[model samples]
Target: MNDHDAAGPSPSPEHHPDGVPKFDRRMLESLVCPRTQQVLIYDADAQELISRAAHLAYPIRNGIPVMLVDEAREID
Candidate 1:
Protein backbone atom coordinates (compact mmCIF):
# COMPACT_ATOMS: atom_id res chain seq x y z
CA MET A 1 0.00 0.00 0.00
CA ASN A 2 1.11 3.57 -0.61
CA ASP A 3 2.19 5.75 2.29
CA HIS A 4 -0.75 8.06 1.76
CA ASP A 5 -3.18 5.18 2.01
CA ALA A 6 -1.59 4.03 5.22
CA ALA A 7 -1.90 7.50 6.75
CA GLY A 8 -5.49 7.79 5.57
CA PRO A 9 -6.77 10.82 3.73
CA SER A 10 -5.88 14.16 5.20
CA PRO A 11 -6.02 17.60 3.61
CA SER A 12 -2.43 18.56 3.71
CA PRO A 13 -1.35 22.00 2.58
CA GLU A 14 -1.21 22.25 -1.18
CA HIS A 15 2.42 21.72 -1.87
CA HIS A 16 4.12 21.37 -5.25
CA PRO A 17 3.62 17.58 -5.18
CA ASP A 18 7.37 17.48 -5.65
CA GLY A 19 7.72 18.49 -1.98
CA VAL A 20 8.13 22.18 -2.74
CA PRO A 21 6.28 25.05 -1.14
CA LYS A 22 3.42 26.41 -3.21
CA PHE A 23 0.27 27.10 -1.24
CA ASP A 24 -1.21 26.29 2.13
CA ARG A 25 -4.75 25.37 3.14
CA ARG A 26 -4.27 24.54 6.81
CA MET A 27 -4.70 28.26 7.50
CA LEU A 28 -8.32 27.82 6.56
CA GLU A 29 -9.36 24.80 8.64
CA SER A 30 -6.86 24.57 11.47
CA LEU A 31 -9.23 25.64 14.22
CA VAL A 32 -7.90 23.67 17.17
CA CYS A 33 -5.02 25.44 18.81
CA PRO A 34 -2.16 22.98 18.98
CA ARG A 35 -1.33 24.09 22.49
CA THR A 36 -4.62 23.94 24.31
CA GLN A 37 -6.85 22.54 21.58
CA GLN A 38 -8.70 25.84 21.62
CA VAL A 39 -10.06 28.02 18.86
CA LEU A 40 -7.73 30.08 16.73
CA ILE A 41 -7.95 33.23 14.67
CA TYR A 42 -5.88 34.48 11.82
CA ASP A 43 -4.03 37.72 12.49
CA ALA A 44 -3.37 39.10 9.04
CA ASP A 45 -1.78 42.27 10.36
CA ALA A 46 0.91 40.39 12.26
CA GLN A 47 0.99 37.64 9.64
CA GLU A 48 0.76 35.30 12.59
CA LEU A 49 -2.18 33.18 13.64
CA ILE A 50 -3.47 33.72 17.18
CA SER A 51 -5.11 31.32 19.55
CA ARG A 52 -7.07 33.45 21.97
CA ALA A 53 -8.38 30.38 23.73
CA ALA A 54 -4.83 29.26 24.39
CA HIS A 55 -3.49 32.80 24.76
CA LEU A 56 -0.73 31.98 22.32
CA ALA A 57 0.34 33.01 18.85
CA TYR A 58 1.88 30.85 16.19
CA PRO A 59 4.17 32.40 13.62
CA ILE A 60 4.11 31.82 9.91
CA ARG A 61 7.76 31.32 9.28
CA ASN A 62 8.86 31.93 5.70
CA GLY A 63 5.78 31.12 3.62
CA ILE A 64 4.92 27.61 4.68
CA PRO A 65 4.24 26.77 8.33
CA VAL A 66 2.80 24.28 10.76
CA MET A 67 1.73 26.13 13.89
CA LEU A 68 2.47 23.35 16.34
CA VAL A 69 2.13 24.00 20.05
CA ASP A 70 5.82 23.70 20.84
CA GLU A 71 6.66 26.45 18.37
CA ALA A 72 3.96 28.83 19.53
CA ARG A 73 4.57 32.11 21.33
CA GLU A 74 2.94 32.81 24.67
CA ILE A 75 0.69 35.82 24.96
CA ASP A 76 1.26 38.43 27.68
Candidate 2:
Protein backbone atom coordinates (compact mmCIF):
# COMPACT_ATOMS: atom_id res chain seq x y z
CA MET A 1 0.00 0.00 0.00
CA ASN A 2 1.13 3.56 -0.82
CA ASP A 3 1.92 6.11 1.92
CA HIS A 4 -1.16 8.13 0.84
CA ASP A 5 -3.34 5.03 1.10
CA ALA A 6 -1.95 4.17 4.52
CA ALA A 7 -2.55 7.78 5.67
CA GLY A 8 -6.23 7.30 4.78
CA PRO A 9 -8.73 10.01 3.87
CA SER A 10 -8.09 13.60 4.93
CA PRO A 11 -10.06 14.85 7.88
CA SER A 12 -13.17 16.85 7.00
CA PRO A 13 -13.33 20.51 7.91
CA GLU A 14 -15.68 21.48 10.80
CA HIS A 15 -18.61 22.85 8.84
CA HIS A 16 -22.07 22.09 7.54
CA PRO A 17 -22.69 20.60 4.11
CA ASP A 18 -24.13 23.99 3.06
CA GLY A 19 -20.71 25.61 3.79
CA VAL A 20 -21.66 27.26 7.09
CA PRO A 21 -19.21 26.77 9.93
CA LYS A 22 -20.55 24.60 12.75
CA PHE A 23 -20.72 25.94 16.28
CA ASP A 24 -18.68 23.86 18.69
CA ARG A 25 -20.94 23.11 21.66
CA ARG A 26 -17.92 21.82 23.56
CA MET A 27 -16.78 25.43 23.93
CA LEU A 28 -19.64 26.08 26.36
CA GLU A 29 -17.85 23.98 28.96
CA SER A 30 -15.19 26.68 29.30
CA LEU A 31 -17.13 29.77 28.24
CA VAL A 32 -18.38 32.36 30.70
CA CYS A 33 -20.16 35.69 30.58
CA PRO A 34 -17.65 38.50 30.30
CA ARG A 35 -19.59 40.80 32.61
CA THR A 36 -20.67 38.48 35.39
CA GLN A 37 -18.13 35.71 34.91
CA GLN A 38 -21.09 33.37 35.23
CA VAL A 39 -22.16 30.31 33.31
CA LEU A 40 -24.08 30.99 30.10
CA ILE A 41 -27.05 29.14 28.68
CA TYR A 42 -27.07 28.38 24.97
CA ASP A 43 -30.10 29.57 23.03
CA ALA A 44 -29.98 27.62 19.80
CA ASP A 45 -33.10 29.21 18.32
CA ALA A 46 -31.76 32.73 18.83
CA GLN A 47 -28.12 31.76 18.40
CA GLU A 48 -27.13 33.54 21.60
CA LEU A 49 -25.47 32.96 24.94
CA ILE A 50 -27.86 34.01 27.66
CA SER A 51 -26.33 35.34 30.84
CA ARG A 52 -29.08 35.31 33.43
CA ALA A 53 -26.98 37.05 36.03
CA ALA A 54 -26.03 39.84 33.68
CA HIS A 55 -29.40 40.11 31.96
CA LEU A 56 -27.67 40.01 28.62
CA ALA A 57 -27.80 37.93 25.50
CA TYR A 58 -24.57 37.64 23.61
CA PRO A 59 -24.98 37.09 19.91
CA ILE A 60 -23.40 34.35 17.89
CA ARG A 61 -22.26 35.50 14.49
CA ASN A 62 -20.95 33.23 11.75
CA GLY A 63 -20.95 30.34 14.24
CA ILE A 64 -18.69 32.28 16.60
CA PRO A 65 -19.95 33.57 19.95
CA VAL A 66 -19.56 37.32 20.49
CA MET A 67 -18.68 37.43 24.17
CA LEU A 68 -17.92 41.10 24.37
CA VAL A 69 -20.16 43.14 26.66
CA ASP A 70 -20.41 45.85 24.03
CA GLU A 71 -21.82 43.33 21.62
CA ALA A 72 -24.31 41.86 24.04
CA ARG A 73 -27.98 42.80 24.00
CA GLU A 74 -29.80 43.78 27.13
CA ILE A 75 -32.35 41.14 27.96
CA ASP A 76 -35.65 41.81 29.70
Cα-based lDDT at residue 59, candidate 2:
90
Model 1, global lDDT: 0.67
Clashes of each: 0, 0
Q: Global lDDT of each model?
A: 0.67, 0.88
lDDT of 2 by residue, 1-76 (tens): 9999999999864875666666779999999999989999998777899999999999987789999999999998
How much is 8 displaced in model 1, in angstroms? Answer: 32
lDDT of candidate 1 at residue 11, scale 0 to 100: 68
lDDT of 1 by residue, 1-76 (tens): 9888999888655444455444354654855676777766766445567888888888766544557878888886
Clashes of 2: 0
Per-prediction TM-score to the true structure, in the order listed: 0.54, 0.75
lDDT of 1 at 55: 82
